[model samples]
Structures are given as structure tokens and as C-alpha cells.
Target: MRQHEAVINVMEEHGGYATLGFLNQEVLKVKDCVWKTKTPFASIRRIVQDERFFFKIKPGLWALKSYKEKLPTDILPTKEISKSQKEEFNHTYYQGLLVEIGNLKKFQTFVPNQDKNRLYLGKKLSDITTISDIYKFSYDHIVRMTQTIDVTWFNERNMLASLFEIEHSTPMYNSLLKFIELQDFYTDFRIVADDARKKEFQSKLSLEAFKPIIKRVGFWSYNAVAELHSKTSELISIESKLRL
Candidate 1:
């Protein structure tokens, strides 16, 4: 109890909110501490659950409270996230990756006439309600509607380099329709989603109508997108160093 108290005091002194690993390290550093045989993290968890000093924001993530401070009533596990909240989180997360991919494409000089205009977000079908309206629209409007890919990387001549659609619990049918409508030879089409949705994606793509383009489409999980984002930074750093 004394040892756990000492750790809590240290945490409070440090302004609270630290990982269990960090607290365990601190406890191990104590000189000839009592209850050394027992695991510090287990003891700390018991103390927190008993006294309620903090809330687990996520696995290995926590938000601590001071003595007499009230615990927040709203903290919930990721699995408990509301439907709309989960959708928003997934949208924002995938949008960030799209932005990253767009920015990275801007740095590519190998592609002739590469410019900022090459990247675009596909217009939602809500912009145009009917197929009849497509006839009255100008060439640019038709192109944008036809190529309504979620994220696109094209060249100065408007040739597509890559395409991506973030399907966060939404039907893949619409995204696939847009991809097929604007199918370009030599362009890469990728569908990004949660890891658990790979089977769902395959089932959707296996439909007879989508057979022609199914072979060209690729699946990218959220974790894969995050990893790509991380590597993009490393590539940019290396490029900067090379230019120096």
C-alpha cells in the first residue's frame, strides 16, 4: 500500500496521466522498496480500480485524477463507441491518410507536369441527382462526376496515377460503380477500410457485374494506411537530406 501510494504521489508530482509501463519503471527504481516481489502494475491497477484515480481511455492509455477529483462519467471503450461516432472517427482517420497521400504526390517530380491540381476528392453523388442531369453538364462537370473517385492522383495531362476509396462501414457498391465508370488502364485502384472488412470487400467485388475490374482493385486496411503515412514522412526526410 505504501509503495503504491508513493508511486501515485510521484505521478501526481509529475502532473498525472502516465502509462502503466512508466509507473512500473518508476516503482522498480525505488531503493529496497517493500512488496518488491509483487508486480507494481498489478498493484497500481488494483489501487486505481479501488480508489478510482483515473480512467482507462484505451488499452495502455489513461487519464488520471487528483485526490477528491470526480471521475468523468462519459468514458467508454472503443467497442462502445456510438454508430455515428465510429463513422465520424473512421472518416476523419481515412481523410487524414488521403491528405497525406495527396501531399506526398505533390513531391513527386518523376511524373511529367506534376502539380497540386493532380489530386482531387471525388464529388458525392448528392451533387447530381439524376443521370439525365449528366447530359446538360459541361465536359469538366461530366469528368468530375464520372471520375468521382474518393481520392485520386493524376498527372498534368489528367491521366490517373492512383485512386483510393475509404469504405468505412459504407456499401462498396457506389465506390465500385464510380471506379468502373472512370476505369483507366494502368491506374491503381485501392479500397481502404478496417482490417476486419477484407472478407466483406471480397464478397462485394466478387459479384458478376464487377468481375471485369475486380482483378485491378486492391484492399488496404486502416493499419496499412497508417504505416504508409509513417513511411511517407521518412521518404520526405530522406529526400530533404539528399537535396542538401
Candidate 2:
């Protein structure tokens, strides 16, 4: 195959992302093609310069325009970009999609880490009710929920029900506080959970407090996924313990 085709094949094999150095090493083996021809380093750069090919990711690497992007919105129409803007938009759109997908995937992968922790506790909310239950549930939920895949899925009803179940036995304020701690404003259910409580609890904790926990869970799960960076784009801090 030609030099460019070989490079494209490498990008295709690695999920549309690759380092330039890695691509260069692969191109050296072609028999008829020189180390410079079959896998010519400049050819990769040349291919990217063309409009038909776009850089879908970076610091990671690139892919073809046909690759599916896991962005919140679909790619804008090609016509949306002026002739000159097509290349720019392609880069812009690719970066946007990468960030969006990275964020969601970070959140998605977070759940399994907590899953292991919750599984260890042996007392998931589905299995409990009453004040004491709430107390235990809160502790478990706080640690586990931080790694929850879908924060938006929780509601005040469920949160309250979980609380009621916990309340039946114990009155651990810390657990209730932890429950309130896991919420985020972006999701509807979280908003309800935030609103269900008295103003004191609602107003006390800042949004930033909740984020680090969620991000840590996200990072933990992300670490499990691969060598790629975690969802939070940072390493997970091991400061908090998941006590049952």
C-alpha cells in the first residue's frame, strides 16, 4: 500500500488515535516501499493537511472524517463550514466531541469502582429501609454514588425513600448529609434531591465539594479502562475511605 494508506490503516487499527512516533515505527516494514515510502513520516502530516482527512483527537492522535464521534450533538453539516472553515471546523468539532465523550465516559466508567465497594458493603439501598438503614445507606451511597454511572437518574422520591428506609432504624445526620453531597445541578433528579432537603443542608455545601468526589470516582473507573487519561482528566485522590 501507499505511505498514506499505511498510516491510515494504523489510525484505523488504534481507534482513531495514535502518536506520530508510533505511526512512524509501523511504516518502516514495507518490502517494496522504503521505510520512508510505505510509512513516510511526512505523508501522515500531508494527509492531515488535506480537507477530507481531519484530526479527530490529539496528544492522542487522528482519524478519518467517517469515524463516529460520541459527542452530545451530531456533527454540523459540512456546508455549515465555509470552504476555508471546513478544516477549522473539522478540528473544532473533533475536539468538542473528544471532550464531551471523555466527560461522559469518565462518568460511565466511575460506577464499576463503586460497584466493587458497594458489593463489599453488602447493603445497597435496594436492600435497605429505615433511619438506621439510611445511615448505612448514606455511607455506602456516598462512596458508591460518587462512582455512579448515572447521577441524573436519582430523584428526591428515591432519595427520600432511601432516607426513610434509613430513618426507620438510625438517625445518622452524616449519611443524609452525604446523600445531599453526591448531587449535581446539571441533572434533574439531582436538582430534586438538592431541593427536597431544608435550606440549611441545601445551602451549606458548595457545588465544588461534590465534584471532586464524583471526579475521583470517575478517575478510578477510568484507571480501570486503559492507559488513557481518566474522566476527570486528573488522577484519583485516595483521601476518602469507603466505610460500610
Candidate 3:
């Protein structure tokens, strides 16, 4: 690719926030795109203007911003969410929360389950632009919990209680499974290699295996997710805590 295209690709990868220094280094390293021949800084600006590749946050720093193709406006709630709606909502919301934490941790370090949508934090973490973008993405995901769980179905006044009862085990397991799937681990492999093992595991399991896992997972995951939200509530928080 040409210098401009190369820079655009990097910005695309890093959510439109590639530094000039980093771009210069990577482009120079590429054998085809000779450092002496191509004007990287100019190409970066050109791509930003032409392809809407990205814009400046500080002086020379640029990040990816995919604001064009909007996410779906209509939110889908869970099925049969009325009577046990609080439990369901808590599950979904905390799932998102765990996801956000996982995403941040992945950004900071290597996480095994980086691909799963723990709580719809992919959109929030990917291609961040301004501080407002960070807030908006987080806010959007948090609100989506209500849409999925149907807060009105469970509690008239105590929203917290309604959100606090969702079992976390299933969602956490789901998140881990999602990560494995992203890594191209086949489900059929589980059926072949671990099917009998799973059956035996299930058979040997106690009733607590089901309810206790969910309850503890729910509680812990909620703490994990809620902490992330609280930590990243402001731009200062984003900069200081999230390192965004």
C-alpha cells in the first residue's frame, strides 16, 4: 500500500488514533514504502481529509473514528423477561460491564478472551475519537442493559435490586465461550473431545453447581463491570484510569 493507505490502515486498526511518530516508524520499516520517498505526515493528513480517516486530538496524534455507519437504534430485550426480568437485566447489564473491563484489560495487557462481547464493550473500546466519544459509547452500552432486561417488568421503585439478581456464571461462561469462538476454536471439537467429560461433569455436579455459580458469577461480574463504569465516567477518569 501507498503511504497514505498504510497510515489509514493503522488508524483503522487503532480506532483512528495512530501517532505520527508511530506511523513514521512503521511505514519506514516497510520495504515497499521507502521512508525517503514517501511523505508520511502529509499522507496522514490527506487520508484524514479524503477518506475521513481520522482527525487530530492533540497536535500530531490521530485516532480512528467510525461514526458513519451507526449502530442499530432498536434494542432487543430478552425473552420471557417479565417475572424474572430483574434477574435477566442484571445478567445482561453485568455481562456488558465485565466486557468493558475485559476490553480495557486487553488494551493494557494480553487477555485470553479478548474477542467476546462481555457487555457490548467492543463498540465502546474500538476506534475511540474524542472524550465525548468515550462517554457516549459507555452511556449507550449501559442504557442498552435496561432495554434488554426491561427494568419496568420487575421493580417499580428499586431499580438496583432488580439489576442485582442476575446470575453471572452463565454470562461469564458465555463470554469465555465467545472468546474461544473468536479464536477459531470449533464447537464440534467440544462435542467430540469434551462431550463425555461435560456429561460426567454435569452428572457429578450438585444443585449449587447451577444456582451458586450463577449467583456468585452475577455478584462478582457486576462488581467488575460496575467498577469499570465508575472508573471511566469522566474524561479525566478515562485519561487517568482507562488510559484512553
Candidate 4:
């Protein structure tokens, strides 16, 4: 079997579409296809760009061209759906990526209660999150505020390590102001949104009110977040084999 053929087979088994991280993890297991290169992951990345056989669904996500029409509605929302519904799916998809990435990095993950029921791929966000309640590492008021964050990663000490807010179509101000509330903490903040909105994010972060966190906060485009997620999994897989 060919390399791209193996990737296609794996994607087909996954119902037509799969994340770059998923392909990197599963494509290597195909016994018939021998990946002789030192950078098989890179090869997979290049293969997905063939375009003749696959199509990109989103950042870090691709689907077999043959099965595009058969993918789940959530994976490829149609024009018949409301704009809000499409936005909702995109938001949760990134949240799911963050949750999985945090878990792989040995951090406890969380999402707001209202998002707990949203589907990330086929699984519920609540089902995949590591914690049901935010750690009461601070005052009641502070903890309550943290619970409403889009996605949060808590370190082993139960301290906030990072907070990510997906700004698909929402204002960056809301997420930035929310981050401001937790500015005292030694945590990193990111506004995850489209590359087109990067200027908007920077402009919002420049406001006098956000100056306190200007150094601690950064803008992450959707593609960047997706790339981090896919690469993180690759590194973990390497670590497993390199452990002494």
C-alpha cells in the first residue's frame, strides 16, 4: 500500500474526516505501508495537500474527497443551517482541541457549563474534560469567574496555567476583559480567532485597560492553535518511545 493510501484508509475508517493529529497517530500503524522517511509526519502534512484526494475542513483537519458528502452535519455544516449553528460548532471544535491538548500535556482541562454538552467531533465536551468543578484555589468569587472561561488548563498544583477563548465571531474585548479579571495569576492568556481578526485582537489588547496583561497575553490564530494540538500529540508519541 502507498503512504497516502494508508492515510485515506484511516480517514475512511474515521467516517471521512480526521484531524492532522489523529492521522499522525494512526497512519503509522498501517503495516502494509512502510514510512521510510525520518519525518513521516511531514509527509502526512504534504499528502493532505494533494487536493486531488483530500480537502481541508479546517485548521488541523482534513477529509477524503471521496467521502466529503458523507461527513456528519456538524463536521461540515450546510448553508441550510443558521450562521449561529455554524459558529457554535467551530467554537466547540477548537475548545475540544484545547481540552485534548491540555490533557496530553498533563493539565486538567475545563470548559464553561453551557459548553459542557456541545459535541467536539462526536464526543461531548463534558465527557472529555478532566474536571467537573474548577479548583477552589482562590476565593469563591474568583473561582466562579474562572468557571465561565471557554477553555482553561490547570497545572498539577491546581493553578491556572493558561486560558483560551475562541473568538470565532465574538468580540475580543469580552475575552480580554475576562482575562483581565484573572490578571493577577501567573497564567498565559490567548485569544484564539481567525488570522483576519489578528489586527483586531492586537488593537483590542492595546487599550489602556489591557496594558497590565499586554505582556502576558498573545493572539493565536486558529491555524496556529490547530498546529500546536497536532504537533503536541506527535511529541508525546516520541516521548513514549524515548523514555529512559
Candidate 5:
């Protein structure tokens, strides 16, 4: 098979649509296609932008031009849906990406109780996540605060590896406050939001109130997270192939 044909075939298998992240994970697995370059991932990125074969639906998501009108409503919501509906889809979509990334990295992931029942792609967020309950790594009050974080990655020791809050439409400040409670622990504090909101995030993080944990806090734009998830999955896939 031709190289672009491999990507197209994968998208077709996925109902004519696939996230760039999803492509990174699956496209290279096609045995009939050969990736002769040192940067197959970069090649895949370039191929998805070809426009002749695929069209971008949103950040990190692409679909075959042939299935544009046939896509499921939830995959590509119509204008008739409320703004909040679109926000929820985006929110859970990123959450699902994070959970899958953490799982591939061999970490236990968790989502808030309120979000447990929410859909991430076609599966419930809770079902995809490794743990149903948050680890009791700290005091009751602290655990209470941490449990509500949008998504968390816990190390094998059951301590927090990272804490991510998807601030889709919410204030980044509130998420920062939650990070404050765990300053003593070595944890990666991330605010996942739109790249456009990066300035707003920087402005809030500059406040003196957040100074103590300021150095540890970081911002991850939605696109950044999506790309990271893609690259991580690609790396893992390569390693697994080597074992074969």
C-alpha cells in the first residue's frame, strides 16, 4: 500500500474520521506501508494536512473528505446545539486523551466523581480510567481537593505524578488554587485550555498568591496536549513493534 493510503485506510476503518493522535498510534501499525524516514510521525502530520484526502474538523481531529456529511452528530456537532454542548464535547474529548496517555505511560489515572459518568468518545470516562477511587495519599481535606481535579496521573507509589484541570470555559484561577494545596509534593500542575487563553493563564499564574507553587505550575494548550498524546502513543507503538 502507498504511505498516504495507509493513513486513509486507518481513517476509513475508524468510520472515515480519526484524531491526529489516533492516527499517530494506528497508522504506523499498518505493515503494508513503509515509513522510510527518521521522522515518520512528522510525515504523518504532513500527510493529514494534504486536504486532497482529509479535512480538519478541529484541533487534532481529521476526517476523510468523502465522509464529511455522514459523520455522527456527536463527532461533529451542528450549529443548532447550544454552546455549552460544544464545550462539554471538547472538555471530555481532552479528558479522554489525557486518560489514554497516562494509561500508555503506565500510570494510574483518575477523573472527578462528577465526571465519571460522562462520555469520552463512546466510552464512559470512568470506564476508561484505571481507578474508580482517588488514592488516599494525603489528608482527608487534601484528598478531597485533589479528587475533584479534572484528571490526575498517580505514580506506582500511588502519589500524584501530575494533576491536570481542563479549564475549557472555567477560570484558570480556580484550578491554580487546587494546586496550592499540594505544594509540598512534587507534582506537575497543569492547566489545559485553549492556546488563545495562554495569556490569561500567564496573567493569573503571575499573581503573588500563587508564588509558592508558581514555579511548578505550567500551562498545556489543548493542541499541545493532543500532540503529546499522539507522540507518546507513537513512541510506545514503536517499542511494542520492536518486541515483535
Candidate 6:
């Protein structure tokens, strides 16, 4: 029986015990290991392909027999998200639809307190060119415009077309405050949130603090936004066809 030359070489270099750890250490020391063996290349390939064996030969190095012992249990598992994460995801989803609506209306959309560097809803709405002079728009003015509003669309005349606040899982009080601040302006004010929260919205609106502006504000569900988006798209398509 002829022994593989590579195995013989490893034994000769390491003396007696060519343990897996010892072989790995020797392989690390040498830049490359030239195997002088009668073993067929096909046989070598088969052995290397086996998951049980960790044999890798690269341009400048060769590692043979590096096996990690399997643990009894999984080291990593899927994790459950926190309430804040769910709320954030919901907020992003509703804000994305508002961004689409602004685009369809051909109005400049602004997301106050948004990081322009962060990419959301295809492209950041803050990065898009707006009709409002950003340099001239004061911080206080932007705060008043966006306070708790998730999205605001303005025409070229710098007049507000629509104001939107996505309540998601958040309390409606802050959004209502923003609506009250800008209610004097003639524009559509909408609170977009989950349909399940309709009663919660009504309850908040019934409060004495919110009574004065309750009639001015409107509520929209996620489904409502989707329907409006679809209708707006259809309208734009029809207008384009008429132009042709």
C-alpha cells in the first residue's frame, strides 16, 4: 500500500502526531504547500468538497483539515421586533405613499426634520428640488410647516396644497397640534393611520382641546391612501392621453 506523499510529508515535518490543529499551524507557517502525492486530483477535489473537511488552497496559502466543532444549539436565531420598530416601519410606509401623491400632483414635497442623506421611498423627498426657497425658509417656518406633519406639498407659488400626518401607532395629539397651527391656511389637512385606529382618532377629536379644529381635520386609512394613489395615477394617465 502506497501512502499519499502529502500525508507523508506532513508526518515527516511534524514528527509523529499530525493532529488537525498541528497541521493547520504548519499550513499557516508555509506560504504554499506543494503536495507530492500519487492521489488522483479527482480524489483530492472530492475530499475538499466535503463539508466535514476544511481544505482550501489559494494563490499564496493552503489550509488543510480545519473543522469547527458543532455546538449543541443554534448560536443565532430570528429576533422579535420591539413596538418602536413596528411604529417606525408603519410611519415609513404611510410617508412613502404621501411622497408618491406629491409626485403625481407635480408639487414639491417637503419632509421636515428629515435627513437628506438617508434614502427612503426610492429617493429622499428632501433631496428633490422644491418650489419653496429652502434658503429663505426659516427654521421656525419649517417647524410650523412640518411640526408633526409627515409630509407637506406646496405649489410653485409657495402655497400649501396638502398637509399629511401619519399617526401609525403614535398618539394623534401631536399631529392635531400641527394641524391647529396651520389650520388658518386654506389647504387640505389629513391624518393618515391604520383603519383600526378610527375610534381612537374620534375619541381624541372629541376632546375639548381638539373640538375647535376637529371639523377642519379629516381622517384617512391606509386603504384610503392606496385608493387615492390609484385614482391619481389614472387621472394623470388620462390627462396625458388627452394631450396626445
Query: Each model's TM-score, in the order given?
Result: 0.53, 0.27, 0.24, 0.96, 0.92, 0.58
| 82-134: candidate 2 lDDT, tens digit per residue | 65444433333222222223333332111122222221112232222111112
Per residue, candidate 1 scores C-alpha lDDT tens digits across 66-90 of 6224322222315566787656544
Rank list by lDDT: 4, 5, 6, 1, 2, 3
Most accurate candidate by lDDT? 4
Error of 5 at 145 (Å): 1.6
Write down the lDDT of every candidate, Cα atoms only: 0.55, 0.34, 0.34, 0.91, 0.89, 0.56
Clash totals in order: 0, 15, 11, 0, 0, 0
Q: Model 2, poorest ten-residue lDDT window? A: 160-169
For residues 1-244, what per-residue lDDT tens digits would candidate 4 score against the true structure?
Answer: 9999999999988888899988888898898999899998999999999999999988998999998778788899988989999999999999999999999899999999999999888889999999988899899998998888899999999999999988988888998988999999999999989999999988999999999999999888889989999999798767766872
Which pairs in model 5 have colliding backbones? none
Candidate 6 vs. true structure, TM-score? 0.58
In candidate 2, stretches whose alpha carbon ends up further than 4 angstroms from where it belongs are 11-46, 52-61, 65-139, 149-244
lDDT: worst 10-residue window of model 1: 107-116
> Candidate 5 lDDT, tens digit per residue, 1-244?
9989999999999899887878887898899999899998899999999989999877778889999888876678888888998899889889998999999899999999999988765679999899999999989999999998999999999999999999987888899999987899988999999998999999999999999987898899988988888888788878887873
Mind sharing the TM-score for model 2?
Answer: 0.27
| Best TM-score among the predictions, by candidate number | 4
lDDT for model 4 comes to: 0.91
Off by over 4 Å in 3: 31-51, 67-244
Give residue 179's lDDT in candidate 3 (0 to 100). 23
